[model samples]
Target: MSQDPSTEVVARELRGNILLVMINNPPVNALGVAVRCGIVAAIDAADADPAVQAVLIIGTGRNFIAGADIREFGKPPLPPSLPDVCNRIEACSKPVVAAIHGAALGGGLEIALAAHYRLAATDVKLGLPEVQLGLMPGAGGTQRTPRLIGAKAALDLMLSGRHMGAEEAHALGLVDRLGHSNDILADGLAYTQELLATHAPVRRTRDAQALSDRQANRASIEAVRAETGKKSRGLFSPLKIVEAVEAALDKSFDEGLRIERELFLQCLDSAQRAGLIHAFFAEREVLKAPETRNTKPRAIAHVGVVGGGTMGAGIAVAVLDAGLSVTMIERDEAALARGHAHIEKVYNGLIAKGRMTTDAKAANLARFVGSTSYDALAPADIVIEAVFEDMAVKQAVFAELDRVCKPGAVLATNTSYLDIDVIAASISRPADVVGLHFFSPANIMKLLEIVVPAKVSADVVATAFELAKKLHKVPVRAGVCDGFIGNRILAAYRMAADYMMEDGASPYQIDQAVRDFGYPMGPFQVSDLAGGDIGWATRKRKAATRDPRARYVQIADRICERGWFGQKTGRGYYLYPEGARTGTPDPEIEAIIDAERARAGITPRSFTNEEIMRRYMAAMINEGANVVHQRIALRPLDVDVTFLYGYGFPRHRGGPMKYADTLGLPKVLADIREFAKEDPLFWQPSPLLVELVERGANFDSLNKSE
Candidate 1:
């Protein structure tokens, strides 16, 4: 074995006529500067050595190469760039083999494409997922992938940023062969030796004939371009990917590479790239809560879910999907049967969609136990209360759990707005109580707010995070507050929209502006879809404490009072005829709004879409700043992740906090102050926002500090 003198990351050893080059970077073996240089040096050594007839490249750890080293993001350019390294490998006189195991993504997959042949382990995952980070593959990935797999498949892989398993990759011609052994090195050596014995000729992806049919390639490119335009509306990279793939068909191989590199640079320089990179890092950072630092999560095998409503059944399904056994308790046999039916309905839908087989559904259902009695939950490792959103009702559920659950079992609440600290205080095991605020459609939504009360133990918090990972959910640690991070900020921003509606803007106009700003739907649309009665109930609950002097919008209340509780009843701020999913503009709603404005003795004014977004974003950012300052959220990124995963905040803009940073804190504060001039009570600028602007700092700085 010989280590390259320049860098130790790459090592080479001669095995008969084959030279094995191993990348020794730990973890995912991200392609850093040293690794790039080392690979070039090793390739050089193999080409010069007489004993080495073929070179086999493989990583030593779990992954072949996950991607670029994220630590080097936004840093100065390093020597022997990934593009150069890929060209070196492709230019080697000797045949090169890449043995892919685990994840071979982004630049890593690009390097594999540059090799003469590719062998992947059965469990290997391959993709060019740079589009997720607001980048198309820079180092020949765009130029070569289409040549290897054709334009449609390559564009699909890059655009979706989804991992293709080994079988799928082999079928798509992305992988030359699939290994049957557990040891990647052994599989690679055998494959390389077989290639040498056969005297196989060098195969470069650039020289492939996949793009020989120019007309077909153009057709595929245009199809993808149309689809991308519709789906990736505000995104910058997906369209560039289509353009680069088009270049591969229209330009020469070398020229195509040049175009790819140029487009990649453009994507890298885009503000969307900055926002996406921040979101990428923020997701990983949000999981690192102070409580989870040294503390170990408790072992959770059997989960108990209280109630049999939609949220409860969803939680049960999520737990079952995570491979945990669930014991569900309902108040009565009819409700228990409904919960079971709900669980089965999900599997039945999956079955109908061909995503799940009958056997798989049966297997998952076998682990689920449902009963009307609470005694059935005695053996549960954790009991999650998903009852009504009332303190007294939640207290009753916890009191039962405290009496029946096994010692050390985690007690969690799925309350959306109730005070969890009060619920914890009412129970005997206050230390075991933690809030696991799963969003509606709990099994589907990615966000899980792990609300930590004052009395909850660190281990319990850690356990909640662990549970989140098990359920394939993004966990954001939240200090106890009325609505926690996402909902609290949501309430503030939704109020801003309501204020706009009552002042001059129509709900339809505000919703359209919000959608134009990248949210999937506006606050009013969301309220309607979620059933307007839900928010109406919350309003009535807080009505007694509502400030008398503050402006109030009674339009929603009036709509609900007439039994038109949104889509369920087919009427809201918008009309949904015959239970249609999309609502239409309602003349009655307009009349109601005009009457309300007259009742409040306020004159109506028109708002431009841009003007509407300014106030809406100002409200969200100001509340997000306060959330971080009050430690309801540990950092700004936590708030970002919460909204990104939960509230349909556009991933391209990052989250509310990240959007604020990109928009410039001073401008956001200015907007807030300007709005405050009209309604100081509603637009009270967050002190943290004001402080950050005074210091010329941004939310990102606070993220770095935490």
Candidate 2:
């Protein structure tokens, strides 16, 4: 309205009947103070102009409004907050519509709710996704959306904050129509003209009630509390969301709105909100380094996997599923046949789950080439080595690949906890050697820890990131070290769990504690699932390399040695429990721990779940600090991303390091010091944590250094 750079709204008069208003913020058209002020002025202009009978608010580029800038959240809500802005829009006498495109999310959807009518572009998405950041929709979304859709529908939207396409949204009554951007505008304008001719806008989304019964809404609240309590467990956002939705059901529209606002404010001020938002922003920033985005990169037409083990087979399936032709090499035809059979078994199971159609399975299988020859990699743009986790064997594979691969082909090692520098030492083009550590079932998990050793050229790092994007995975640019980032922290965390077992906690008890803390599975169950043999080997390797630096629990080793490997062995931490789906903690494991503790003259003491969670987490956070201190990670946020996306740290808790911030860095430091005094071997704090605590700083502050 002031005609300033940020204040001016890009408006076009539409055929003397409608004014198409576009918010002109570049990149994502975020609803900032300037944009909100401009919109308020635009509504005033529309009322004053004789030619503009109707108004349609739209966006200029890929999205209508992705959301308010995250930078603006957690700060005080700017005066005339999003709710107030939407109220102004709703109060306008002229018919107003929202022509949404891209992602109309958070505050963006709240603005659209203010309009009397709505139309979204075909490909655009809509969601009230503040819950992901530990906040709910603050700007009247809780009030108006239930009025537009049902209370049940609104609860789902508010609680999960999941994205819905325009088509799905139309079916759900969240949108009035779905079409192309211009078509959506035309439809919205025509609808507005009909309203004008009829004397007033007829359909306001604010009047639709969500749930049928008062008791039913209360029941819904109870249901969500149980669900989120089990699902989120340690996290706080979902439970708060349940309360906000209950407010919607129990109170009047204005009263419900007041409650929603109160809850949103509470969450905004909470450390969880700040932590989750930090992680949210850091994840988007990970793929946006100068080396990844600024350089010219080649397209990946073909890929090669130089192994036929479970890891290699999974990697090949992911590549083929991404519509890239893949050739997998094995030691012989028998191994190739075995790997191909494994792939078939996985695909068949997927088809059974309705996740993959027969046609999709056929296509993916068709794209896979299984062979035992070096010539299979002739056309590969990139080659990933998913061989065994042995240094000498990996060196041999790389030596062979060096002779086989094209001059510029990107070569990567999918090694967990191995030295990438040592792997590259055998290669001619060390610049081209990067580590692409994919978690098992590479196609399913989103985390791809991209290890960029110091010797890796900027272009190679860029190419690794570009390839990760093509594979549709989260690429974390981790510096080279043992286990990179995810497994490195995992190593320490598991050590804590083992330490607990050595003290009085049983395997099931530790599992219960971890799952209670929001991890999907407990460490012992995970170790069993990951093969008890793997942990046994890593322990021996670390033990052989260094003196017993920690209170090493030898119980898991005994289980492995007994060939009670895990779920695969069906007798590791817990027994199969006879025809039961999952195993329970073996009495034998407890007995084993007792025997080991007695043998070492160790006094076994009881540990509460809180202490188990504390020590387990302390080990992880301390290890994360060590990782950062050793330059094995790019930033503290990188450690967060590694855990959140890659290692199943609850998104609501953000990541382990972010969660530590909520726990207070000084408190965590104190706990570590207490443990160090108890046993200086395993409980010693990393220098980074010690310095941060000495400086009265947090991991959030360390993230700033990046």
Candidate 3:
């Protein structure tokens, strides 16, 4: 059979009465225009050929189809859209069987739903994850998914944007069968032949009766809408997804598709969509560090973690989870035992949650070795020190690591604010030293700031990135500095929050405003959760170097002085009565604030939530710009990714840098300049922000240049 001249993305070959239609687009087979056209052309050809009685569609490589081509985002729609292609596939006279493997998501799932039958490989992952990109399914996904699976299941998959295993998909009736064989094509061909032999009829998902129970479907739709409303407060696409699913249950298939397309277009035009798409692309872009371009990562089989405090134990757990053998060291045997217990507790919790088997936990722990001796780490490929934040303590730890580690072994310090250069200088081998700043709860947090000191080798940086990938973490290359990227910017913004708190706004009001702006929690809430003492300690450390001209907010220090160190102490800006996870506003804290205001001789004024956020975002963006300008971060997107993954920066608003770009550089600069009138030293505009505003450029332009 002759291939379509328009595109080569789809190839067709006749296997007896079955015509094999293969998606040849490599690297996840994104359903771009060419692929769409190719599929429609192949379907037409198959229908016209009398020799073809059944059709089997499969992808060439690892994935069947990942999703719509990200490259096509923000571009004008091309002819033979995904919806048209899906409709054509469903309308084909010959029965079509979709054999899915490796990430059949979004448009990929839609295409599968359009087929008469779907056979998924045992390892296949299926989902409609368009809600993550701030868009609902534009094709027939919304309409067909609920018709194939139940309404509740379809909505759950789409809203959560979570992947389901092949068995789950088969159980949900999204897939007809699950293939156990390793060879996908063999299994697919055999399944297709079975269908032909049985004279299977075309079973369009749109014609299915999965959503036949009107009353039940309505209840499920309403239930999902209520849950989504609470969970996705500022998000736009989730509610739209609910609406589309509702349309599927209430309206005809074609009418439901029409509504889906309209809602999809609405989401496409939303600012949230722009921000989310930027976030999606920025994540991939941030992984490309200059050091990783040509340099190969050193093989890391065994890891050593120094110290067994919370941070240390967390890092050890993360390392062990990455399938690396870990040797954890503490100052004494008791501390080592505590660290071992901490690791065991995490696995035990997983077992209790049914997420892990006891056998699996035992097997993972078998690779772990806890010791009090520094000599135990001699066989380690890389040693990460997660001891105290004090410089002298870190220097001593690095000295031990330098002396004990073998040649070319990566010696990493997991310090949040300390200078890696100073730590490297203290060590004998500075070339092998790098800073790996893992956020609190390292095993769960996704961000890993790979802080590169001047003396560290490129291979070491590359190895850090490789390690991050193995740990299922997002790696951002950061130049050595106080707090590196995320925390430094965080300090600036948190200072902004402190300024607002002292100026007029209550901590609760400021927190509420921050929440309204899209963060999962307010700055004060995060401070409480992380323990206010952490920041207080940081403040005390910088006190000697802190500029006297800058306005200092003593409210936190006053609170800490009372031994009210946040959630742990049950009292901070908010009171955590009975160790409640959520805190309530404390009237006594207000009394403290009033006393501080009286002492400072400041007349407090009311501030709106909008005003509060304006200052908060201005501080964050200015510091982010300064980070990019000073080369602490390679690009603006690096800052964006760091905040998005590390900090609780809202993913829907994108990161601080992307938010700045979306909010307009001029507006942010204007806000900074205006705030400068009150606190010039604190509100000083970033030179980079000024330059970008003057040149009519945005942070994204800097990202593109990089």
Q: What lDDT would each prediction earn against the true structure?
A: 0.91, 0.81, 0.91
Please give, for residues 1-706, the per-residue lDDT of candidate 1 as tens digits. Answer: 5675767887778888888888878888899998999999989988888888999999987999989998799999799999999999999999999999999999999989999999999989899999989999999999999998899999999999999999999998999999999999999989988998898998888898888888898999998899899998888999999999999999999999899989999999999999899899999999899999999999999999998788999999999999999999999988899999999998899899999999998889999999888899999999999998888888888889988999999999999988889999997889999999999899999999999999999999999999999999999999888799988998898888888899999999999998888888888889888888888889999999999988888888988899888887888877888879998999999998999999988799999999999988889999999898899999999999999999999998988888998889999988888888989998888899989999989889988897
Write one digit per residue (lDDT tens) for candidate 3, span 1-706.
9986777988889998889988988788999999999999989999999998999999989999999998888899898999999999999998999999898899998999999999999988898888888998889989998998888999999998999998788888999998979888999999999988888888888899999998999999999999999999989999999999999998899899999999999999998998899999999998899999989999999999998888898898888888899999999988888888888888899899999998888888999998888999999999999998899999998888888899989999999999999999987889999999999899999999999999999999999999999999999999988899999999999999888787889999999998898888899899898988999999999999999998998999999999888889888878888989899999999999998888998899999998998899999999999999999999999998998998889998888888888889999998998988888999899999999889999899998898
Residue pairs that clash (backbone atoms under 3 angstroms), model 3: none
For residues 385-437, what per-residue lDDT tens digits would candidate 2 score against the true structure? 99888899899988888888898888899999889998887778898898999
Quote the lDDT for 523 in model 3: 91
Q: Clashes in each model (backbone N, CA, C under 3 Å)?
A: 0, 7, 0
TM-scores of all predicted structures = 0.99, 0.93, 0.99
Query: Candidate 3: where is the Cα deviation over 4 Å?
Result: none
Which of the two, 1 or 2, has more lDDT? 1
Displacement of residue 231 (Cα, Å) in model 2 is 2.4
Q: Tell me the lDDT of candidate 3.
A: 0.91
Between candidates 1 and 2, which one is better according to TM-score?
A: 1
Candidate 1, residue 97: the lDDT equals 99
